[model samples]
Target: MITPAPNVPAIASTPTFTDTEIKPSQTIAANTTTPPTISETLTLPPVSVIATEVPPVKSTPKLANIEWLTKFRGIPGIGVNPVDAWLNETGTTSDPTCRDTRSPSCDKHYRDPLVDNWAAIRLTEVKIVFYKDELEKLITFSGVGSSISNWFHINRVLASSWTTLVGRTYGYFSLEGDAGNGQRFFTASPYQGCTKDRIFTLVITKQVASCAFDRHSSYPQFLFVTGDGWGYPENMTGIALADSFAILIK
Candidate 1:
């Protein structure tokens, strides 16, 4: 066995290595280029502000005082056509009895009172006379009462109503004289000729102080006539009278 071992190769042994020293990480400079400074500004379109001014609203004026001049007795007063006045008063145009266009006058009757009841009268008839142009030239109010006292009361009431309507006062000047202080008189006659009728007259002028001289000069006049007896034989005292009041505008 010893002669055979002399011709065999030798076996290699495991190698042992010694520990090496640890080294710290080294710092390296970075070559970084700051991105080219790209500054961009945004341009905006010009803004326009428009101011619109609103107009102020206009206010209407008040007409409380002079409103009655245009409207009275639930109808329009003088200068209006009789047909139109009738239509307005009755709210009808089909009433043939009220007016006839062929005639120069229109007659209307009222069964009820048109004014305050305490005034002791009722408007029974209204006769409107027109010119060729169909405009009213004269309007007459015919009323009948139970006694003479009622007649007098109604006359006084009509005078008061006129005073309120025209905003004037009664004066005491003669018919030939001037109406001083812008006031005029109401002329009344208890006996007018053989007719034995009571009559009342008032003349209104455009100028307040010129009534007497301006009576027939295109001014409006009011005349009232009333009586019970036809002739001189009958007694007129304490009797019912037919009152006819007329408004004349020339």
Candidate 2:
């Protein structure tokens, strides 16, 4: 009685089935499209097709310390003549009170003897030649604004002018510092240095000049002479004047 509790479970009645065909719409809709599947992909690095490179900059020099490296001597002695100037009197050497400063008075002129007419040292003879030597020195002054602890001197200076005392038209007096500008030149009383005393012999190559005879500019100018020795400005002024001139001190 327990045998096989009815595999079919005892349907009210055993039924028989007949096979049928599927509809056209049903088969077409299900199979017409395909399903997506698992797969792989790819990528790349960074770079530029049109690229370029770059660099840096530079600097320059200072002129304050080396003021003497330039064409301070001015125009050459194209028309200057020569003279014979030597120390006379053979007196003991003395220090100059001139202090490199000048005034309108003839007595205080750096180049004037105490007596206006007393020739200090006749420099008109070699004034131009001294400048010629100076020209050589200037040739090497290519430092432009670079510094130069230079020493300009003159054993003596004569008039560069042919007629007037210090005018270029007739003669050249002496050169100031650079351009007739005051910054170009200076003259303090002699002090102890390699640049003291040699004012008269200052073969200063880089200097300019301003003259009552032929001034280059309106600014006051001076002659800076420093060297190994001092001279008697008094004797230099009276008759033994280094020459007849008025110079502006710093």
Candidate 3:
């Protein structure tokens, strides 16, 4: 009985800032292919008010490039939290060719390195409204301890919270106050999954705010993939999106 061994999954190429071909399930062995790396930078507005006047006219959180869109994955019903009906999570079955809309799911574990996808499509980039905590910043950041300004940007990321029923993983980045200071802030993080084969990339530099990863290798079967996109927590709701779109290149 010459039973052939189970075919090892493909060893897909590393992710690139501009690579359009994507796939599902990949597996690189020890001393195998190198994973891709990514990073991103966000342009934000200033946050300073030193007025002794009383009327207290407020300003909207000015964010550039706002968009709104939707997605459809297999695990969850329909995702309305991020936006409207176009977003979904309908492809969580064992079937490799299930209806995979690509919307972020609150539950259900998805296979990575999928045989059907290579890139994410933009859904929205418009604006929404959220009421931020109006508490006054009592700490007056000055000379010696003046680095207090940078704290705002860093803190926004650290203090975000979300609870997923499917136990998915994620990461996010955005400029803090650099936009106000004529500088841009960038944060990059990789997505995590239950698979030890889990991998992602994050790169932060002068004019780039991008990230990339593969749940499985392009060298592997997309049907067997297992990972999620970088996390976009719910706390970011009503924060206003600039513009968005989705893509299917492979």
Using lDDT as the measure, which candidate wins? 1
Task: Look at candidate 1 and tell me the lDDT of residue 192.
Answer: 39
Tens digits of lDDT, candidate 2, 94-199 = 2244222222212211222221222342212211111221221111112122211221122222222212212112111223322232222222233233222223
Give the winner by TM-score. 1
Q: Can you tell me which runs of candidate 3 are displaced by over 4 Å?
A: 1-148, 153-158, 161-183, 190-250
Tell me each candidate's TM-score.
0.20, 0.16, 0.15
What does candidate 1's lDDT look like per residue over 30-106, in tens digits? Answer: 22434444343554444532222445578775532222211111111222222222223443233333233333323
- lDDT (10s digit) by residue, model 3, range 33-134: 655544335543444433433467787754333332211222222222111111232222333333333333233323333312212322112111111122
Comparing 2 with 3 on TM-score, the higher-scoring candidate is 2
- On a 0 to 100 scale, what is the lDDT of residue 214 in model 2? 23
- Report, for every candidate in turn, its global Cα lDDT versus the true structure: 0.28, 0.24, 0.24
- Candidates sorted by TM-score, descending order? 1, 2, 3
List where candidate 1 sits over 4 angstroms from the true fold.
Answer: 1-53, 64-104, 109-250
Comparing 1 and 2 on TM-score, the stronger one = 1
Question: Which residue pairs show collisions in model 1?
Answer: none
